[model samples]
Structure formats: C-alpha cells, structure tokens
Target: MKKAAPVKESGLGMMPANSNSWNIETHEQFLLSELLPLVIGYAKGNRHPSSAAALASFITLSTVLQSEGFTRNSLIASIDASRMDIHNAPEVLQ
Candidate 1:
C-alpha cells in the first residue's frame, strides 16, 4: 500500500487577537431567526422598528463567534448587512 502524503499545518498556528470563542445558546439562535423576518417586514410599518431584539441576538452571536477564535465584529456586521440583502433579493421569500 502507498503511504499517505503528510498533511501540512501551515497558517494554522495563528489565533485571532480578539477571540471570545463561545457557543451561542439554541434559544438565542431561535430568537434571532424569528426576529429576522419581523425586522425586514416592519420596515414600512406604522410602528417604528426596534433593534433591541436583533441587537441582543447579534451581541450573543458575536460573543459565540469570538469565543470560537474567529473574526467576530465582521461576521456580525455581515449578518446584519445580509438581512438587508435578503430583503432586497427577489427570490429571498420564495
């Protein structure tokens, strides 16, 4: 049998500076998912849009992402921005 090639570990030794790596609670993810649609849908509502729930969700997610030793603020910001992208996409709801 042929020997398997050695796997390289280059670039795997670096840790993110602000890592807050942690796992988000299931309840938090669930709440975020639920709040997302409502957030996008309420853009034109008579009642003003409140980001309390979404912000809380992002903060939780950010903590989890950081705990995992990943870039956190960017991820959270991307997620927030994606919400708007999702709303704008014609096929998003379909």
Candidate 2:
C-alpha cells in the first residue's frame, strides 16, 4: 500500500505557527490597534443601533479569530461579508 504524503503548511487556510506563548496584553493591543478601529468606523458610517450591535459581534468574533491564530485579513473579510449580509437582507426582514 502506498503511504500518503505529509501535508505541507501554506498560507491558504493554514494557521500561522507561533513560537511565543499567548499574551493577553498583545491580544488586547491587537484588538485595540486593528480590529476596534475598523468596528468603530463601521458603526460611525452605518449610524444604526444594529450597526453598534454588529460591531460588538465583530469584536467577539475577532477575539475568537485571534485565539485561533487567524490573520487580520480573515477578520476584515468576515466583517465585510457580515456588513454585506445585513445590507442585503430583505426589506420585509428589516
């Protein structure tokens, strides 16, 4: 029987390998520096209560993504997709 080859790591869908231990301070800094500003800007541009709620959700999701070693681009894409979904919802649902 032929043995399967070992999976090589690449940037696509693969979490980055971290040599250092997890640091809450660093994580907080990342949220403040990167994620929070985006959320805040979204909320300001949207100017709706639901937008504020979505910002909170984005923060929570970002924290999860950070813990999972996901990249910033992933978080940005997620937020953009969520915004699109909200804006594209049926009028009856709004």
Candidate 3:
C-alpha cells in the first residue's frame, strides 16, 4: 500500500493531516503512539458531540480488515506449530 500522510499533533489540539510507518510487528505501536494521539487531537479540537471513539474504532477495524490476509495466515501458522500441554505448567504459563 502507498503510504498515507503523516499525522502529527499541533499544540492547539490540532494535528497534521498525516506519519506512522508499520509492517506487521509494529502495527499496534503505530496505532497506540500515532493514531490514538491523532484521534485525541481531533476530539480536543471539536469537543461538541465528539465521535473520537467511533472514529478510532473505525480506523482500527479498517486497518485490521486490510491486513486480514497476513493475520489469518499468522494464526494458521501458530495452529500448525508444535503443541505443548501447558495445562499443568502454571509456572511457565505465568
């Protein structure tokens, strides 16, 4: 996918239109560090009836959908990996 604009927070509850880079491993970091802040800025900028929660959720869900293939494959891979009986291994589980 082509990169989107980098989003940055302005001092006055405003943010730049777009920058977060991510492959698979760092996607959550990008969301929490970058996207969440951007959403917060928007909420701050327009407080009346703010839909920041919904907006963030939509963006997150959309991102997941776009990357579903990788996600599914990763899950399948884990499923096919060696299995261990961890039910009695509380110390290791903890």
Candidate 4:
C-alpha cells in the first residue's frame, strides 16, 4: 500500500519565514505571535462576520458598559433602541 503524503501542522504553512531557514518550533512561535493577529483581523472580519467583528464588537462594548457599572441588560437594550432610532425612517418620509 502506498503511504499518504505528510500533512502540514496547523500554522506551519502560515509562517512568514523561509521554512528551510527557521526550525519548525520557531516557525510555530512566529505564527502564534506575529501572524495570528493579522490572520484574525483579515480572515475573521472579511470571511466570518458573525464569528468575527460583529461578535467581537458586541463583546467589547458589553465589557466597557459593565466596567462602568451599568446594568448589562439595560445597556444592551438601550443600544438596540438607539440603533433602531438611527435606522428608522424619518417621520416626514412616512
């Protein structure tokens, strides 16, 4: 039976350095530290809207509101109401 080709490890191919110059361990480190932020920002925001920016924005806003000691549910509701107000049609247009 023929053996299958070796599968590359996660983050291996994404490393910015030349694979031959850097050892696999160092490559993995760069992938985690340098590359991940770029990947997350680019890929998540562009490709996966819900899992990426929208979700992140909601979490960040929620955290900030909580730190200010606001009631969480009330703050969320207020934000939603404000969004609806901004998005709602002008009365003259009705």
Q: Which candidate is the best by TM-score?
A: 2
Which candidate, 2 or 4, would have the higher TM-score against the true structure? 2
Q: List the residue pairs that clash in candidate 1.
A: 20-66, 20-67, 21-66, 21-67, 21-68, 22-67
Candidate number with greatest lDDT: 2
Candidate 4 structure, TM-score to reference: 0.34
Poorly placed runs, candidate 2 (over 4 Å) = 1-13, 50-56, 59-94
Model 2 TM-score, 2 decimals: 0.37
lDDT per residue for candidate 2 within 1-94, as digits (tens), equals 6743323332323656464424334477778898767777767778856567665776766765675677888666655654766557444222
Better of 3 and 4 by lDDT: 4
In the range 1-94, model 1's lDDT, one tens digit per residue, is 6743322233323544443232234346654776676664564363555576556556766665565566756575556655775546445221
Candidate 3 clashing pairs, residues 3+ apart or interchain: 5-18, 6-18, 6-19, 7-18, 7-19
lDDT of model 2, residue 29: 74
**TM-scores across all candidates?**
0.32, 0.37, 0.31, 0.34
lDDT score, residue 42, model 3? 73
Query: Each candidate: what lDDT?
Result: 0.52, 0.59, 0.50, 0.56
lDDT of 4 at 87: 42
Candidate 4: RMSD to truth: 18.7
> In angstroms, how far off is 4's CA in candidate 3?
12
TM accuracy, model 3: 0.31
Candidate 3 per-residue C-alpha lDDT over 1-94 given as tens digits, one digit per residue, 9 for 90 to 100:
7754333332322423333332233487777788777777777777833476656666665555444444655444443442544344334231
Question: Which window of ten consecutive residues has the lowest lDDT sum in model 4?
Answer: 4-13
